[model samples]
Target: MNEREVLSNYVYQIVASLVASGVEQVVVSPGSRSTPLAYAFASTKELTLHRQVDERAAGFYALGLAKATAKPVVLLCTSGTAGANYYPAIVEAKYARVPLIVLTADRPHELREVGAPQTINQVRLYGENVKWSAEFPIPDEAPQTLPYIERHTVRAVTIATTAPFGPVHLNIPFREPLVIDFKTQLQRVSFVKSFTNDLTPSKQTLAEFTSIIEQTKNGIIIVGELPLGTDTKALWNFVRELKWPVMIESLSNLRTEVPEDCQVFAITTYDALMKNERFKRNVRPQTVIRFGAQPISKFLMQFIAQSNPLHYIVIDEDPMFRDSTHSSTHFIHALPGEWLSEIEISHVETELAYIEFWKTADLLAADAIAKYGQTANDEGAYVQLMLESLHEGTDIFVSSSMPIRDIDTFLPVLNNDIQVFANRGTNGIDGVTSTALGFSNGRANRKTYLLIGDLAFLHDANAFVASRYQDCDLTVIVLNNDGGGIFSYLPQAKVEAHYEELFGTPTALAFEQVATMYDMEYVKVTSKEQFLATITSEKQQSLKLIEVFTNREENVKEHRALWTRINEVIEQWLDML
Candidate 1:
């Protein structure tokens, strides 16, 4: 076989192995050096190929697919800065434990540091962010080249999907003639290697955990952002058996899935309730057991730091120190499902008074929010209405900054199975729209909703192009305060001279024009009734943009006023306690 034939066969083997390893989605960014692998992936009958023009958006797009599917999604890009664009997504995948297989095309050894057109350091490009990284050799006519490529391809897929799942990078270098002729029929190869890891804790460790649970009288369960594909039912049962007050994060998936009847112990509005200094001081637990990552609520973090419990145990699959407050007394490295399933908890005869106190506090907070939401004309009220209007099983992607914080603070106790997602891994607003679209594409059966701010919407406007081409079932709710609304809550809002220019940074772009340019169905709602009517109408099968305009000053004021009301309600409840 000629050198071109060898390169073609190598690319074919890699793609086939990936398919056999159960990667069904591949996102390819257009480039010359990656032509061979991209064409090979496109030719494969079992693979779904998604084409994207921007590498940064493409990376997050693939991240969303993997997040939704709980499988590895392949990412293909050309050499040079094209590979660098994948860094943000890789970091997210690492922290969020999403599986991704990143394939970047590169120049051969001779082309390195010699002023090649699209050449840079491609080896270990992502640094410590990736789970594994490697540089593949340029395909040659040697007999063993194809087998080596096939084996490594399977290995990369396995690593990406294993425990502590994350992105794995494979820098593939190709020589000249990076295209394959149709006349050369490629041979199919089978890879039969498999990897498995069992991270079940020891019997002694489970006994120790059970002892810890039984000894504590007043304990709290803090649920953070759970890994994708986690058994929410198992989590609910575990919390129910413990009979402890459960503070669930909005993205934890537990908050939306738990039945209202079972939510007596579930504190869904802790973010708002903890803001009351009296409530924070009185609601203290003797023991604290945390699961998953740190929560999105800064108030909860501060509360944990201030109310340091005697036994603060953190249960995580990975051994990383996810505790930012440094208050954890013990870090138990174990899968939450496995640990909860194996450990035997004898019914502890602890007082139900503590749990009842939390339930009362949560109810009072909800009542306060309802009172304010009836007349408040601000972003918090808008988020509450939007969340209540979503149908069961809706996949909602919340953008960072104001949208996520608003939902955490004001969203009501949901009876439906609404799945919430966000790019909280790195918490940047660069690819919010594209990531939501990718998630919508992965979960095509469910209606998807993206709650994003104006600045975040504009930051990822190119994602609308991808959405238009893919025709995802998505409703983009743009909370347009015309600028960075979240900045008003920060200390910089006090700076009168440069607040507008430096922090506010208002952009007067009309999103209706943007919607028209992207051919999306557009609606501008000014009142709460109009907004409710729009979301409750017949769901669209194509992309739609709904804009709700709010004033930054009014939004900030409304939030402060709502919190003040919540404090008053809490004080009343405390008097009864």
Candidate 2:
């Protein structure tokens, strides 16, 4: 093979190997330093190449893809600070436990900071944010670095997809010999799965967990955000025997027929239980049996920290906590499904007062929501609309801040088959759209629904420019309340003049204009009924931009009104007691 052919083949070999190893999505940023890597990925018909111009956006785009697919998505970029641009997303992925495989091409070590353009320290530049970082040093003149390149690529891909997966960086230093022809390159291929093996709980651990469950009849199960394809059946099997109140979070894909005896919305009932004596007695579980990753609400975390149940046991693959409070009585370091599979856990025959009491509270809350939460006046209403409209088994991605909070608070995720994801690790608003679009490329059959705010949508409009979301069943709902809608609900809004100018800098631009610029099908809806009827239709192949018109000022007013009413009810109940 000639130099150009060798280069092209090498790129082909690396991307093909990644595809063979189970990485279906590759997000590439247009850059010269990494032209070989980018070209190889783009030419491959087996792997889906998502082109995002901005390196930072591309990084998060890869993160979103990985989050939705539960597989590592590769990110390719040229040398210099292009790799550095991925740090924010790196931190977000690290905290969210999503896998990101970053492939950055660099100049040979000879160019060592000697006043070279776009040359900064690319080695370990992201610091501690990434789970693993390695460098593949290929000589510019030597043509026999193929074996080393193949080995490192395979190893890097493997580690990135392992359990507790996060971002892994493979900084490749390409010498002149690296820039070879694609057609004449030799292909050394391996079909190894780049994924973590399921770790089952030991017999001893299962018995220990069963003992804890048997000791307390009034136990509560708190399910958090589970990755896609997680075995919810194993968890349901164990929970069924307990006859306990299994509390499902918005993201937890716990869709096996929930036991009739279980309380569906236990996390939201924390405030009422704390204030009402009768309700507390009836609703408080003797033990809290927690499973899955971190729940989204701060209220739930604070409640767990303060309430401190009689026996708290967490079943998960990673022992790390996602919240500020860190106190667990026991943590079973195994997949919840695997742990439950081993234990012959029998259901407790004791009466569940907590489940019965919370059932009534859940009913009351649901009724209230049904009655008063139907308009496009609040963020919660947007969530309710999307949840009611989106297709079953749709992959929903929510941005950080109010978008995720609204979904967590109101979206009634009844199907375990449908996947839901959010950038919750660091909870920043950056790259929400890019990540969602990147994630959609990996799904062959499933459609992706990305619900974002106008500010976030505008911030990552570059994502739309790249045509990555085109032809995918990708629907982006921009809840255009205009300029930082969440700020109106925050304390800053208390000062009207300062709030309107600084915090709530409402942009007057229409949402349709954005869709027009991106050449997407745009639909504007002002009412809940219209949104529900329109979104549920079975349609695929084009990007649909649904712009929901909402007023930030009105949204804040409704939120405060609800909080006031809830607080008043709490005070009245307390006074009566």
Candidate 3:
């Protein structure tokens, strides 16, 4: 076989192995060096190819697709800075545990350090962010080359989807004639690798855990960021059996999954009520059990640190240190669903005083939030209204800064079937719009909603390119505070000298123009009633945006006032107790 034949067969085997290993979607960025891969992926009948112009946007798009589908999505890009653009998404996939297979095309071995155009050190480019990295040899007719390519591709897919799943990088080097012209019969390769492992806990460990739970009268369960397709039913059963107060994060998906009758144990307003020292003193958990990633609420973290529970247990499948407060006393290396399923809990009769206290406090906080809804221009109230108005089985993608914080703090106890997602791994505000669009593409049947702040929406404006081409339903709600509204809540707001110039970076671009340029329906609402009507309207297009304008300073005041009202309600409840 000639060099071209060898290269063609190698590329064909790689794509075939990926398909055989169950990779359904591939996001490709146009580039010269990646011509072989682009054509191979396009020609494959089993793979769905998505073309993206911007490499950065493509990276997050693939990440979102993988996240939504709970499968490994392939990413193809050219060499040089194009591959580097995937760094943000790779970092997020690393911590967020999304499965992605990143393939970057590169020059041959002889071109290293020769000042060749578009040539850079692409070996192990993502470094620690990727679970594994490999440099592929130039395609040749060696006797063992085909087997090596097939095995490598299979291993990459397996590792990417294994326990503590994450992104994997494979740098492919191609010589001249990057394109494939002749049609050749592709060879079939078998994927014989097994990546599944049973993580059943030992009997002693379960007995010890049962003892801990039995001994503790006042305990709390904090649920944080969970991976896609997590067995939320198992978690709900475990928490229900424990019969403790549960503080669920917005991304936990448990916040909305909690049944209506169980609202007494579900503490959705802990962020507001934790600010009251009197409430904290009256209802602090003696033992705290946490699951999944770090919580998004800063107040919750502070509360955990200050409480200094006797037993702070963290259960995670990954080995990473998810505790930012460094307060975890025991770390259980086990899958949450598997562990909870194995442990058998019997009914235990204990004093109902502690649980009743937390239930009363939660009710008081819920009442406080209900009263706050009478005021307009409040972001927290808007979040509550938005969530309440969403239809069952809606998918909401929240931006990192204030939008996610608001949802975390004030989102009510919902019984609707809703899934909330965010890029909380690194928590940067870039590529949010693209990620949401990709998620919509993956789950084409679901109606998607993206709640983004003005700055984040503007930063990822280019994401509209994909939205224009892809046929998906997305309702984008832009919270336009005219500046970095989150900065006003920080301590730097007191720095009256340069706060506006430095932290409050305001942009004057009209979002209606953006909507026009992107061929989206735009509606600017000045009142809460209009905002609710616009969001809940049935006349939304393929891509629609609703812009809500508010004052940054007033937002800060509203948050403070909401907290004060919550404190008063809690104090009143305590007086009755």
Q: State TM-scores per candidate.
A: 0.97, 0.88, 0.97
Model 2, position 474: C-alpha lDDT score: 76
Error of 3 at 279 (Å): 1.2
The alpha-carbon deviation from the true structure for residue 185 of candidate 1, after best TM-score superposition, in angstroms, is 6.6
How much lDDT does each candidate structure score? Answer: 0.86, 0.70, 0.85
Off by over 4 Å in 1: 182-190, 539-541
| Residue range 249-364, candidate 1, lDDT tens digits | 88888777776657788887788888888887777788898988899988888988889898899988787858999999988776667457656788675578878888888988
> What is the lDDT for 336 in model 1?
64
- lDDT per residue for candidate 3 within 1-577, as digits (tens), equals 7767877898999998898899999999899999998888888888888878899998999988998899999999998899999998899889889999999999998898899999999999999999999988889888788889889999999999887889999999999888784485556786565658855557887888887888887889999988666788778878767888888888998888787656667888888878888888877778899988889888888999999998899888777858999888887777677578556666544348877887788887888777777774677778878877889989999999899998887677777878889988899899899899889889987889999999999988888887644565689999888889999989999989988889998886559988998889999987889988888888557889898887888899999888888888888777887
TM-score, candidate number 3:
0.97
- Candidate 1, TM-score vs. the true structure? 0.97
Candidate 3: residue 434 Cα off by (Å): 0.7
Worst 10 residues of 1 by lDDT: 181-190
Candidate 2 has a TM-score of 0.88
